[model samples]
Target: MRALAAAALAGVLVAALPATAALAADPKPDIAVTSAADKANYAEGETFTITVTVKNKSSVDAKRVHYTGGDSEGVDDVVYGELSTGFDLAAGATKTVQLTGKTNHVAWQRGYGYVAFELAADNGEANDADNITSVRLMVAGAFDDLGGYVFQGESYDAGWTPQTPGVEGVKVVATSADGKTKYAEATTDARGLFRLAQLPAGEVLLTFTAPAGWKILAGENGEYDHTPALVIADDSDEPQIYVPAKKVPVSSPSASPSASPSASSVAPSASPSAGPGLPVTGDNTMLFAVAGAVAVAAGIALALVARRRRVHLQA
Candidate 1:
């Protein structure tokens, strides 16, 4: 009776193992970022700091988690901060991250910039909507932008023809008229649009740097008083010199026949000639053996002669 009772208890425990594992396999961690600015107002180009509070609201621990946030316009655009570098957060726990940023030179007439951020985790989440947050700051004054679009162009004897496709990743820079001081710089995006804000009031030179394998047809370098009005049109903008794409040369097949002869074309002669004009018949094994020996001797002699020539050349 004792052995039978022990077996029944063991069977019950075994049956419960699957349920326990199924419960353990289900992971739910909700990550969220509660963002706030350190101050309400910042002067144009004044550096400021913000805090982002990261929270895991679920009962389960969140693992391999990270957070992403930056200035409203772009990362480090008006504000910058250190993002979470993948960490584990205990159940219902929260961690705060800090970021530093400079207020943009160009802002609304009333002066306002936004800081945005989001949170994520490797473990599945219960809800994703609450993971993002943003904060606004008042920045005084407005600034001009050095911005424009770059396009593809084709060159002809008369002039250049502009195309609709925009060139991306062109480095645009704003500098003083003498090319000494650099005010702001930015790279063109997919739409070939670039903007450099925080530009001081003065004459500036705009230089465009093309990516690898691409040439700056026009607007390589130019002077501007105000934000120069540049369009894809030639008359409206500077002369855009476009070089056509190079043509690939085609190869033609050679006229010579194949160097190697086919096996079917190679065949044994009908009569076996043992010597010059000497055809042998059956039972010529001895004759063939003698001929093979002579041929081997001639080969050894030729090899020795070649070796001797090599030695002489070395000497």
Candidate 2:
């Protein structure tokens, strides 16, 4: 009887175990950051728009899914600051939330910057791996602006250091470090200064199609033409790029000096013939000399004949 009673209790406990487990395993929302992106082309001293996509991986809907943004301080692993933004995410669905953040000066020591995003739900998350994400950040000084002049000639050895005179009306393009994505464009003003604000810091490439007859000065790398340049934009780094321009046709001066003078001299070909007074050229002077000689000889011959006739009559 005792063994049967114990077995019955054990069966009851086994049945109750599932109920306890079910109670413990509550229905929770699993939210995670699937992707994090910089919504705007960020620059130093400019505000950045960070977009975080949160996915509800659980079967239950995630209510009041909130997002926060942070950045690692220059060469440091610590992240600070939380942007205030939130949204509701349906089960098996994704919601994107945007927040604005001001970036600090770029960390040149690390050679790059970074931004982090965290996604959470009202209840709780089942997995943490997907809830946090980070990406490469590009920034300049938190309050600084980037601009410079484009002129003709080779860029001085350390030209990008200061704000030099700019070339007006030049179209400049700023692209992603990979050179595939275009961020923004600006036309230099009358002062030759063109500014794209809130630009991110990283290996950014610039594309400038110099004027038809102009060429951008070669950079420190010794290559002219704004094709691909890895520019580091930070407070410690040089925010301005001074480009010295050289004329496109390098041989122009040499080619022009002799051509104009030579052409003008040849154009006066008919001027000598059309002159108001006759020009005494070598050919014209020879003709005049021959005629004078013939006249003098005729006079001498006539005088000789007169002398010979007088002598004959006397004889």
Worst 10 residues of 1 by lDDT: 225-234
Give candidate 2's whole-model lDDT: 0.61
Q: Across residues 1-315, which tens digit of lDDT does each residue of candidate 2 receive?
A: 999999999999999999999978878888767444454344444555556566788898877776544445433333222324456678899766554445445443223456665767777778877788776554443322355566544544535333445556778887866778887787777666667554544555666666666666554564755644444444543336656655566434544444345553333355566766446343566688799999999999999999999999999
Query: Weakest 10 consecutive residues, lDDT, candidate 2?
Result: 74-83
Kindly list the per-residue Cα lDDT of model 1 for residues 90-130, writing each as its tens digit. 88998887777766544333246666767677777778799
Work out the TM-score per prediction.
0.36, 0.36
RMSD values for the candidates in order, in angstroms, are: 27.0, 14.6
| Candidate 2 segments exceeding 4 Å error | 1-12, 20-28, 34-41, 67-71, 74-88, 107-112, 140-315
Best by lDDT: 1
